[model samples]
Target: MLKSSLNKGLIEAGCDEAGRGCLAGSVYAAAVILPEDYRNDDLNDSKQLTPHRRYELRKIIERDAVAWAVGVVTHEEIDKINILNASILAMHRALDGLKVRPEAIIVDGNRFKPYNFIPYTTVVKGDGKFMSIAAASILAKTYRDDYMDRLAEEYPQYDWISNKGYPTKKHRQAIAEHGITPYHRKTFRLL
Candidate 1:
């Protein structure tokens, strides 16, 4: 079971990112502000769920949340700003897309910069513990997966459709054999 709120009083949004460790494609993040009284036991860390379940939850999160938005930083931007900063910036951009302003934020990881004047808490595995964070994780992951699938069509040799741009042995092998695509993160060690 996941808790509904970090602080019962404040309007809170949970933030998370995906594809930070990928060798190719963009980094994506999501900010999700669920209803204060929301409850859904199936909601957990996105990484814990299968693709079918994640997509199912994505629809639920989108439908039930007070506000939810995804942000993406392209591979080029990741190379320019570095993955850490790009991940945080992607979260900020997601927050920017939210129609309902959050009074506070709870991030899924230990790294974050201040978002405007909104106070934030950094949980080591917030996605597994908090509903909003779990929702954010689902959105970020599924959206990024969708994007990777599209990119896979453009660069089928990278096998992104299967690996979703993660640095699997086959993905690295493809990079070594076929050379780099525009979506490859040059800053990352592809080999």
Candidate 2:
């Protein structure tokens, strides 16, 4: 079972990002500040849940959480600053959007820059272990998925609807055949 949070009484926000590995499109991150007493057995890593379940849980998380916000860093920015920095910046941006500031932050991965001088902990696989991080994962994944779905309409040849801009065999083939889109991260290995 995922724990509600790392800190018991403090207002904690969980941070997570999606699309850091994608070859195209923007990276998205979410900051979720759930109530300290919240609990949901179904919540887990966004990756562990199906797309349908993630979307469903998104509604619940948004409705029940004390506050939640999403942030994005575009492919162009990713190319300029690199994925790691962009991912961290996206998390900071998410925190910027939160209506309720957090007293602490728990991040899903092991790397994060300090945000607003709040105390923080970086868990290697926090999404699978903490409810707020899992919720943030769901929001980030679903939001980025929706953005990619729209991009798929613009560049159907890349099959982003299927691969979501990951470096899938088909996606790489599309890059070989048609070249990169504005959404492609030029710094990434496209082929």
lDDT of 1 at 103: 97
C-alpha root-mean-square deviation, each candidate? 0.6, 0.5
The lDDT values for all models are 0.95, 0.97
TM-score (C-alpha, index-matched) for candidate 2: 0.99
Cα error, residue 22 of model 2, in Å, equals 0.4
Write the residue-wise lDDT of candidate 1 on 1-191 in tens digits.
99898988899999999999999889999999999889899999999999999999999999999999999999999999999999999999999999999999999989999999999999999999999999999999999999999999999888899999999999989988999998899988889
Clash list (residue pairs), candidate 1: none
Cα displacement (Å) at residue 75, model 2: 0.6
Model 1 misplaced regions, further than 4 Å:
none
TM-score against native, each model? 0.99, 0.99
Q: Report how far off residue 46 is in candidate 1 (Å).
A: 0.6
Clashes of each: 0, 0
